[model samples]
Target: MGRTFHRYKPQKIFEKELQTSEFYDCKEKKWVAVIPKMKYRFVIALKSDYPREVFDAPKYYMMKVVWKNGKEQVFEADTKDALGDAILRFRTNECFWNNLGRYAYRVYLDWVNKSGRLLQ
Candidate 1:
């Protein structure tokens, strides 16, 4: 019998709407995706130690929300879909309001009203 060879294709992680451009961070030496918002931005990076091809989806993602005033929070998810859901929750005010306070939430609302998709 002859040996068989098969080509491998990486699976897509996030849906179309949840997808974002990724860039390599020289300081961190990892691939990361940055999602910008009205008052803060989410930085999601691969937690794996081994290097991966740019198109490959990692198993673990680490999310960091960096606020305008330099405050930041960290979160983790096993899949990219879950990470996207977390970001959506923060954007739609489903959670995390208390930490940001009422004032920040109002500001975010105003921005969403005035600029619409500019928040994304």
Candidate 2:
């Protein structure tokens, strides 16, 4: 054989520059996604305390998504594989374009690490 061609690896896209924090959710009884940079600090609301409009905002609320199989679930940052799979499936399957596509896109950006494995 004169020559052989092999697939070339692309340059790494993620810089690993983002800072992340692990917070425990006492109500959910599980670890939540790493908190990204915020312009303002988040307020914690106690069950016994008064209700605040800011606390009910979408940004402060935990993101919940429904799967294609009709099961609803909360998206977590710790589970990269599941998020990656969902991203891939969402991109490839047109039927899911309307349902969980929006949530999957958000999770894709959240869970994708420096390795960029989910992009592949």
Candidate 3:
């Protein structure tokens, strides 16, 4: 058997916009993307150990929304584009949070039903 490797071309469209204000979080030891809006602050953390490089499509990433009330909601995605799309959707619609939360809940239910394991 031979190992085959596939190379994916990095998508720079969102990366260009997101790269403007990325900073390393010493506490988490990961690069985090920050986009501040009037209602809340959107943050995306990439699961990478190397500090020098930021992958355009990180295999694991987390999206977090921090509102003025100090309550936060966190969502995890396997690719950066998924989180980016969520952010773009929210930016366009103020009511997107309700939909986002519903969608996340549905996904969680599906996962639990299929895997028969609770998410930690």
Candidate 4:
């Protein structure tokens, strides 16, 4: 057996919005589609609930997405710290921080570093 390591392939989609596919609403007979694919994206997930913060500073963007039988994984957009929270709210909105914002994103990174939250 050999050890395996994941290469640092930052997802480009993290800087953008997350979208999802659409299914035909048989009852309504309406072709519905989610603007962004949130199936495997967290930044996109943020938009589903938090739109205003999507463009907030600090610029939190999606990094990556992984799925297992009962778990998920994700990553961030920028390597540098500091920025506003206005755009960082969404995991997809990428941008560099100013100065003070660096610390804020660092703290946020604590939660951001997690692969995924356990489904309670």
Candidate achieving the largest TM-score? 1
Better-scoring candidate (lDDT), 1 or 4: 1
lDDT value, residue 49 of candidate 3: 34
lDDT for each residue of candidate 4 in 14-87, tens digit (9 for 90 to 100)? 22222336434545656566455323223222212233333443334443333222244443434322222433
Instruction: Count clashing residue pairs per candidate.
Output: 0, 0, 0, 24
| lDDT value, candidate 3, whole model | 0.45
**Candidates ranked, most accurate by lDDT first:** 1, 3, 2, 4
lDDT of 4 at 2: 71
Per residue, candidate 3 scores C-alpha lDDT tens digits across 1-120 of: 975545543221211011133434555656566565224444445553333334554345665555445677776666544654544455444344442443343443443355454545
Instruction: Give model 3's TM-score versus the native structure.
Output: 0.31
Give the runs in model 3 whose Cα sits over 4 Å from its true position: 1-39, 48-59, 85-94, 97-120
Against the hidden reference, what TM-scores do the models get? 0.33, 0.26, 0.31, 0.21
TM-score of 1: 0.33
Which parts of model 2 are misplaced by more than 4 Å?
A: 1-79, 111-120
lDDT of each: 0.46, 0.37, 0.45, 0.35
Q: Worst ten-residue run, lDDT, model 4?
A: 93-102
lDDT of 1 at 104: 35
Model 1, residue 19: distance off in Å is 21
Candidate 4 residue runs with Cα over 4 Å from true position: 1-56, 79-120
Model 3's C-alpha root-mean-square deviation from the true structure amounts to: 15.3
Give every collision pair in model 3.
none
TM-score of 2: 0.26
